[model samples]
Target: MRAHRIALWLAVGQLACSPGRARTSSSPEPAAPVVVPAPTRETPRAIEPPPTVTVVSPPAAVEPTTPQVDATLIEGPAAPAPASPAQHARLLDSPEDPEPKLRGGIVKELEDVSYIVGNEWSLDAFREVITGLGGGYVGVGPDQAYLMMGWQRPEFAWLIDYDPKVMRVHAMYHALLRHCGSRKEFLAAFEPEATDAIAEVLDDAVADDRVRRLYRNNRDMFRWRLRSIERKLARRRVPSWLTDDETYVFVRELVLGGRVRALRVNLLDDLGMVGIGDAARELGVVVRVVYVSNAEEYWEQYAPQFERNLAALPSDARSLLLRTRLVWQVNRDYVYNAQPLQDFLAWLAAPGVETLEDVVGPKPPAQRDRINFVLTTARPP
Candidate 1:
């Protein structure tokens, strides 16, 4: 397999260099040099709420369903704790081994900016299942990540996506979360009237040139998406990080404390996925929940590396895997699915388990909020 990959990569390199093909700016840029910023303290601006609005108190934290397992320290010299948010962000980058290249022709070749907001429609369905299983998080996409991370209050979060544009939007999210004190202020920054505020925040918080440039270029679209998210959360009456003060503060602290990291990492990549597992282990953080957001729909069969990556994550009996599938037979949008990590691994290991449909079945439960399922069995936990 190693020899075959080397030969294939050599062929790709020849093609890349031999042609007169002009590369487009839409392609993901090469990794940037690490620059840790000096830590500075600033009190967030406090904003008052409207007279009619009522704030919901965040629920008390819940104990893990199972006992926590301590991570056995990696047998090597230990690194000192990171001093700043930038330093922590640097830790989440792809590891040096396996060279961090993507599969499937740059791993999902489409580079257009993502739906900066999610289309999942019913993330609230996951609130009870995922809440308070705090450890570390690995997931894809934009706002949906924040929602799950907020509910779980994970010790750290790595928002991994194949698209660099998605990473740029997440960069913007980090900056906005860092600067905005109140939920009102955070959502307001996405409005046209807050251009100056947004500029100040972006200029100070985001250091990567490519991330800042791309984000500014598509600010309008992002602003629209974020505002739409707030409207949807309100219309649904779902208490979220945007709608609740306590949830907002928790997510804000994760960002400000430098525990939230967003990066481009393909799930099937040997480097990034393994790197996430190793990083989590070194930090002594269990990956309690992983939200893939319908990414499985893109592939018909699981790659060998996919199995390896899932195994590498340090999980316990209580650990959960969350995904959404557009089972049109149930709802026009998506049906949220959650499974115990152990059960999911068992299903993946079973013979003839080729795709999501093989595991989740041809149709989801008619009551869309359901979670547990066997290869052909669906049941409520």
Candidate 2:
């Protein structure tokens, strides 16, 4: 249809030449109104990526789909021997100090929505695979921040989601963690501003206009969220360093040092422009771990987009992706339709086996809360 709609002016011009005269068309009508919203959030980077993702007013245009190019998941002609624990520890660096630096866009249209994920329900199996890789980008689910904060200790960590608002929720928590030195102090930030004068004073800097606005808009939800995190932390078994004071200091250092960035990005998208993908390309970064909690289960049309995201990343051997899948029981009344994480680089190398069903197998596993760990490193660094 597009090709068929050529200018009738060409036909008309030919006829007019017979009379040796040309006619001009009237002026075109005004264009449609378009508005763009400014990018609402960016968690600090190892070296902060400037100050914005540049969300516009009317809304940004959809990003072009990335053309699928195959990457081999098979072993290469030669590979390097793995680094030893001592060398790996040197790569882990210290939690107290982080190298700050700067680091996609947009099928996600809703910027104001976010889910409140409290606990970081863990699968112990991922620890070795995750920790094996040296420092790089670490992306995780909406759960407890401590596990990744303590274990992976990537050079930079990004809390990613399809919802900008969800990222904003993380931003609020980052603010709390950065400013409040104790669990009590952090909890107090959500209390009525009237009562928590100390919290307001301490939290004031962290509580940017957007964070305060989110608090003002959904007063109850945000409060409930803060309480939920407190309860989750209270119940979990974590490293001693994760004690409230330690966690606060760690988070404070990370944010201020620009080693932690919370991005509201669709994992299925190319993510080349705004999130960790951009950081990888722009900064020559090698990402070691990316965790997507049960999100792949919800993908429909954008399903293949996940593959694109994996392809976009530049990685080294030992990189891991952690994901969760729900297993249903015959007698159970409730079950979630989530899938496990896979070695994305391997999936690309192997032939056949195209969809999630291939990896999860035919029947739902009998166990409860099983997590899948996939090796994503295609070759040695």
Candidate 3:
């Protein structure tokens, strides 16, 4: 029995050890795949891509280069622009530096003379008078003091005794009185000296001999002519009514009388006494005074009379007389017959109107027209 039991155990062990097969009972086979109804429209599905990974290396660095500067370029601060030609010229032409101020004392000295002389005398005359009084022109101080360089000249040293400024002032006073005298006679008395001074100045300035000779001739002729006229007027034996104040009054009254014709006739009749030449010469002066003092009447009477008188005189005499008449007329018109006879004489003595030709011949045709127009025009009351 034990052996039997052993065999059975061995058999059981062998059976247990052997792998057992699963039961062959089959599950029901899946129902034949019912073709899922094909979708009404077939749709394509997007395919998914597989994910990918990558590795990369770092990049290498490039070397840097230094910038270069251009040497020819104008890199420094800009230079100032050049000046234009006109600007340069103006700079060159500028006036020189002013002289230093004169000393106060010297200025005072000059002022003294200036106070007395004022602006009446010409600059040349002022200088001459100052120099004549032992004063040097240079180094003069305003206080009327002189700086002496040399001790030897006593003439200059005399300045120490007399004030040069005072002397100069006095000299100018005398000079003015001499040249512009109060009375006609006094002025006439100074004529010779005046003529000399004028001649000297002329000599220095006028280089042309013809012009100088012409000037001298005219002066001599005027003197002779005037003297001759005066002698004739003296012969008239008419008492002198032409004192400084009365002359203008007498002239004015005669012009007012429609007596321009009568006065002219009276003048012509007195020709023997007035000398034709002198009458002619004085005509302008007389008429001018008449015109200015009594312009309305003078124009009415004198303009026509002047034409008549001019016509009456002989051709040669006409020029001389006309010149004289013009002189009278200008004096009356411009000077108002207020000037002394001496002043009138000085004016005549000037360069341009020194002769008869200057009086009449050169008168423009326009002047004749103007004169005629005045004469024929109706009087202004």
Candidate 4:
């Protein structure tokens, strides 16, 4: 595999230099020495709320661990902890791995952001819908945060993925933003700084609490995350815009002023670590939107757990579950695809539908299909 990759890369390199083929902005030639701004103490302006008026509470003290939910953690007067940028930086010091509650309680599979370069054509549509629905989002998947960057403009974004490597990737991003001020310097230093010997990186960050803890306990995890990011870049995941320092600053500025965060949270957590409802209440805002991607398509068998998770999230009439759909599964007739589905479900919950066997088969769509499926609490239960 290594040899094959080397040969393929060599071919690509040759193509880049081979001829007088005029390159577009998407494909650039050699890079020039770009001067990225040094880390600045620039205070970011407060992000204004979206059309639907989403909100979150003030920043609180960063917690040191993800202890399993207890009485004090779950229903207390203290609102759910905001997934602040500074709060995530605190995870850099986690002494051990934070584990997601798995079904079998066994490690059967492990991977995140597999360096796959493909047509993520739905990203534009996802961004459009979420932006239209307004903000306050928590999503599941690796790097989907990048997908929602410009448009979603969320008040709070929780980028949750199942894989530890995925969370580590996010952590590396956290470290970068905490350290670098502008794009050019970030592009130059991110890999080198994060991937260096743990001791060396720690020396510069001696005063940072998160940095010190990361150096002490979670150094190996940080190294793997840095390596994964570099691999993704080699596979061309890094966009051309990020290459230009000016554009980098421009894009980053448009994204929330350090309000987003990345973390390891499962959709099936019994107590709900990615507590959308809890956070919303704590932040004094409604969680108007959520992006589950196609997770439901593959994990629908765990519906009981997933349903409980959703029920726990604080939602209202305006809230919507943004999901995709498979073409084959969509019903052309019912149109319960919108409000009626919830009504039909409410009916089924009562005892009257027991005699009707016809309602058992054909159903709603999956989120990954050409026409994605969305869920809303349009009908009063």
- Among these predicted structures, which one has the highest TM-score? 1
**Tens-place lDDT digits, model 4, residues 157-248:** 66665544344445545555446677555555533355464435444644333343433333333233334333433233333223334334
Estimate TM-scores for all models.
0.69, 0.54, 0.16, 0.47
Ranking by lDDT: 1, 2, 4, 3
Over 4 Å off, model 1: 1-90, 93-114, 327-332, 365-381
CA-lDDT, candidates in order: 0.57, 0.40, 0.21, 0.37
lDDT of 3 by residue, 184-270 (tens): 432242244455654444455444333233223233322332233233223422111111212222222222221111111122122
| Error at 364, model 2, angstroms | 4.7
Of the pair 1 and 3, which is ahead by TM-score?
Answer: 1
Error of 2 at 362 (Å): 4.3
> Per-residue lDDT for 253-290 in model 1, tens only?
77777677776677777877788888888778899998
Worst 10 residues of 4 by lDDT: 13-22
Runs in model 2 deviating more than 4 A are 1-113, 118-120, 123-134, 138-146, 191-210, 216-236, 240-244, 272-275, 281-284, 300-304, 327-342, 362-381
Ranking by TM-score: 1, 2, 4, 3
Stretches of candidate 3 off by over 4 Å are 1-195, 201-214, 237-381
The true-versus-predicted C-alpha distance at residue 57 of model 3, in Å, is 99
